[model samples]
Target: MLVSEVPFHYKRPDTIVYRCIETPRNRWKTKPTVADTILVVEVVSPTTVTADTIDKRSEYARYGIQHYWIVRMANDDGPAVSIEMLTLNSEGRYVSNGFRNRTDDYAAATDTLTPFPVLLTWEQLDEGID
Candidate 1:
């Protein structure tokens, strides 16, 4: 299951991928530890670039989150954004899987690297925004 802005210890990531039973509790009362999370995604903004790319990257790796994805929204009118995939190594550090950017070739932007492969277009990302 996927949840957004869920608490993981003291940090609340933009998105989280976790395993949940069909009949999960009406609400999860406690924070999920690293063991409960499969992946965490952080959407980068101008003010949070350092925190997302460096600080949170280290913190999430230290916590042993299986996967960490850093998303950078593009300012131009080409494609929506780019994603950097990081996987934890045996040494308890994150190694780059690769960076995926949506180019003119829409088919090439497919998310085959992540556990969840749903494609998100710029329109879907901009929904409900001011």
Candidate 2:
């Protein structure tokens, strides 16, 4: 139900999965491993641009996460949750599934937002903002 910070463990001896250290702990009290993750959404910041857009994007794809979303919520030209969606393709690489903005509806690639059957609305995510 919660989008917890989970790491992906690989069979390969040396694989690096990114980690986020700062947290409030209400939502991510339990961390999950990468393999256990169904979807990974990263909220980008200036310091995390390289890691989120490049390294994490590559690693998550390689690790075979079915759904990956890079959320640019703050730096956008306007007020909107600009979502860059990626889905794992047959060749084991992540391909773009197009983009969605705040006004747009994101019915999760998994088709359900999980734990609750509903469209992925901006209001759903805004709950934590206040």
Candidate 3:
């Protein structure tokens, strides 16, 4: 299951992926904590580069969220966006796994280590945005 803008341990991530069983039941009505999260994604805006790239990166890693993705919007150069995929290493730090740009013909997939593979494309992400 995926949720958007839901609070976790400290801050609300842009999006989060978790097993349906791990999420709170409807009546309990609570958000998943960092421990329940399998993946967390942050969309980077001009003002959020540092917070998403550095601050939250370390925070999520420390909290043991296994996967993190950073989505960067298009700049003056073009309408192309990019997604940077990261995985937690044995040292409890995030390492770059893959990066996909809008101009690329192929979508990016999560590695086999993840519970399931997710296919991401810039078009899918940029939909509904101005």
Candidate 4:
């Protein structure tokens, strides 16, 4: 699904907070800051690569997004693969705790997941599904 399609909400003790709920001018909603358990994914392009890697990275960290996946699609090569994964640390800063190049299988830290799983690989991504 596209990034815009995901529903964002803030969870309070007694109610759910929604951003940009009653605004005509605020057509596009900004990222959520509720600190709920969620995953945010951004598909990267040449033009948006820098913004995705730098600007949004800061924003997502500011809002305490648990998992941020930057999917980079290569030209004339293969499907998109995650170039970087940032996990929020205890110090309220995002650390590049995980990464995978075009030739490696992406793996998360064992503490991050039970039984620790490797999510994807270059070969699996390059093999385009029909």
Candidate 5:
């Protein structure tokens, strides 16, 4: 949503698309053709986990958003869970790309990925987010 307010130009092999609209209802909108190869992340909650894992999974597949992630946090100490990454397959199903516990580095998920090349970690996320 942060980036949607800005206008930009997207060029494809056959088209030079210009998007200038602002204040759109759904800022996370993605085109079906390119959405299958894009990454999407959503913070998970007790009520939302099921939807994120099942409902949204299907929706993303329908829309063709290839990669999706659900980050969950709980009170248990077994694992300071923070992040989960899902990658879409040719069959339109998402597969677990990675899961990071409290101390694990999140940067690994960004390698070789477009629009997300920076490294992140649970420690960094928890430091300020609580």
Candidate 6:
């Protein structure tokens, strides 16, 4: 499935999450469950700072999302992508895998990895809507 800003959940109906689904299935007719998601990426915003860092972190773990990625754009001092990767542990909680921040080469860092190759760069993500 190739969609943007779509809702996903089973038990929690009131809360809706929109992720950059790396590989959504073609037959999906409803919201994606954790099983349906191989990888999840969230672009952090001012309004969602807490939600992305705290609330959603725990929620996705509870929902059994295997891999979670948070992308934060750099401010005035630099133009870069800050990526935080989390892997779900056996205890159903997330443990930090590390980050690809301003000084790191975004593409080289995430291009080759397990579950899914992110294959993303700060420039592509920062491109203005045409």
Candidate 4 at 128: error in angstroms?
6.6
Q: Give candidate 6 misplaced runs (Cα > 4 Å).
A: 1-31, 75-80, 105-109, 128-130
Best by TM-score: 3
RMSD of each: 5.1, 9.3, 5.0, 9.5, 9.7, 6.9
Candidate 5 at 29: error in angstroms? 12
Candidate 2 has an lDDT of 0.59
Tell me the tens digit of each residue's lDDT in model 3 across 1-130.
Answer: 2233354225688888865565456743465655578888998887888999999899888888889988776672334477788989999999888877666776542233454666645555555565
In the predicted model 3, the residue pairs found to clash are: none
List clashing residue pairs in candidate 1. none
Error of 3 at 11 (Å): 1.7
Query: Which ranges of candidate 5 are over 4 A from the true structure?
Result: 1-37, 76-80, 103-115
Give the better candidate number (4 or 6) by TM-score: 6
What's each prediction's TM-score? 0.70, 0.58, 0.74, 0.55, 0.57, 0.64
Model 5, position 43, has a per-residue lDDT of 58
List of clashing residue pairs for candidate 4: none
Give candidate 1's TM-score. 0.70
Q: C-alpha displacement of 111 in model 6, angstroms?
A: 3.1
Q: After superposition, how far is residue 108 of candidate 3 from its true place, in Å?
A: 5.4
lDDT of 2 by residue, 19-129 (tens): 443554564444445555666777777777888889877877777777777777656332336767677889988887767666555544223443224255565555656
Candidate-wise lDDT, in order: 0.71, 0.59, 0.71, 0.54, 0.53, 0.63
Q: Per-residue alpha-carbon lDDT of model 5 for 82-119, expressed as tens digits?
A: 66667778888878776665655444423334235547
